[model samples]
Target chain A: MIRTLAGLVIVLILGAVAAAVIPEMQMREELQGVGYSYASRGMDETGSSNLVTAVIVAYRGLDTLGEVVVLFCASTAVVLMLTLYPIGVKASEPSRIVAFTAKVLPAPIMLFGVYFIAHSHLSPGGGFPGGTVIASTFLLVMLGSSSVPDRNGRLPAIESLAGLSFGLLGFWGIMTAGQFLNNAFLGTGTPGSIISGGLIPLISIAIGAKVASEFSGVFKAFRNSGGEA
Target chain B: MTETLMTAIVLTLGGMMVAAGIAVLFVRDLLSAIIITGFVSLSASVMFLLMDAPDVAITEASIGAVLATMIFLWGRGKIGDDG
Candidate 1:
């Protein structure tokens, strides 16, 4: 009876809130009006065909940087936790099919990831998704193989270098353009060209490297901990 | 016409999300629950795509649906079978 009453109260509150907010919700037409204006301005300002990429890497770059830092911190915490309670046996050998697919898949995946990062300024993908795709390739490698050889601490070094480059690039922007992460340092070439969107593609590459290494590092740490691959 | 079609897709995906959420709550098996959670993330990604947010959709599908599930399954292996 009490549970039923509680459910009723929750439903009542949700209904009331929805009723209040529903009328105020903007329709698609209204949203498109605002979005179109932004898209027009964003295209000119960022000199990229992909407005979303411009928004993420050019207009709201500081926010993206903060987001990268957050992911870095989270990966760091995962590493720390694994270090504290290192447990789990090495992963057993995967099945033959898994092994075969793993061998066949990683190269293509890496290539696609690189393409995604490189073409982000002119396409649908960007650093974050591209990085994740690359990391997933690493994950596939770890899954298929019984033991992956240690890289003599290369992953963390890559991560650190990428992060440092990102920061330095931001500072370069500030020095050149009077705004942090500004794109004024490089010329905004033709809109759909590979070299277009000054500072965006560069930043995307840095972020892609940093994020990919960070995630791969996290997976490595977790694998090293007592859990199987 | 497009608006109506979009609304239909949104409702369908939203319903799927709700079903997945409920399944996650009631599923006894931890691994199954984690998979269901991935389904929820997948549905959410679809919703994001319907909303014209491809960047967010990609992020959601990769990190939320794929990576999070992989991590959860890994953790579950460490925790043993009962969980």
Candidate 2:
């Protein structure tokens, strides 16, 4: 243990020395010329205020679809883990004070989570962040009521359905527009509005649901482990 | 005006990451260490925003905060306190 600690200290000191000795790293390149033009074109054509969303869901739609698949695989692994282990433990009733706080907090948080998910297109929060918030709310529910059943099966069902819908949407894009996850068919409406970003908002909703379910599944597994031992 | 505000956000975000790293090093508890790592991930996301890479930021935040925390909890099954 002492050796490991000494090694970590040495590594940190060496890293600090190197950083002090070397010139600062310039990580970003200037977005000039056609790159800017293309981005501007995306903003104009997609009618979306969030350039990042336009780039991800429109310009690089295929990548986003693959990311969703990755998330699905991760969630599937978690489901398989819980199934194989089958930790059938439940939360013991906590102190009344703890239970009361948990009960009161979740409803307001759930409302906020839904609000964030819906307003994603128009605001700072998006599908993933909104989804995490929603997941935490579900966690609050598990903590509060203590009445919900083992959520392992429910998680898989929700995750699979959401993944399927997202995949089908991508496949539909290929069928209709000869490209994957193409929003061109849906018609990009007016810029800077919630309803204007062609299929982006719908896609965000799907992503939110998928992420929320997966996160909740992971939380459930952790809680089960705690309950057991 | 917007540019100045953005720069300030960048600085604040960077400072927060540094603070979190320092805190993680000082803390002895493994669970707290894992939790601080989550905060580090969040600060990184904010830095990503300042650098104008919101896509990378979003992914980093989600995977870093949510996914990494889950992985740490799972791995904790194998590790013990002060062992």
Top candidate when judged by DockQ against the true structure: 1
lDDT of 2 by residue, A1-229 (tens): 9998999999999999999877575555877786687576876677677776667667776787788788778777875687576654545777788789987997887787677667665655667777887787776676666555354468767777877887788888889889778876788787766677777787778888888888888777666653452
Q: Local error of candidate 2 at A194, Å?
A: 2.4
lDDT score, candidate 1, position B37: 96
Model 1, residue A131: displacement in angstroms? 0.4
Off by over 4 Å in 1: A1-15, A28-37, A227-229, B1-5, B81-83
> Residue A160's C-alpha lDDT in candidate 2?
76
Most accurate candidate by lDDT: 1
Stretches of candidate 2 off by over 4 Å are: A1-30, A33-38, A86-90, A149-152, A225-229, B1-16, B19-26, B42-79
For each candidate, what is the lDDT? 0.86, 0.75
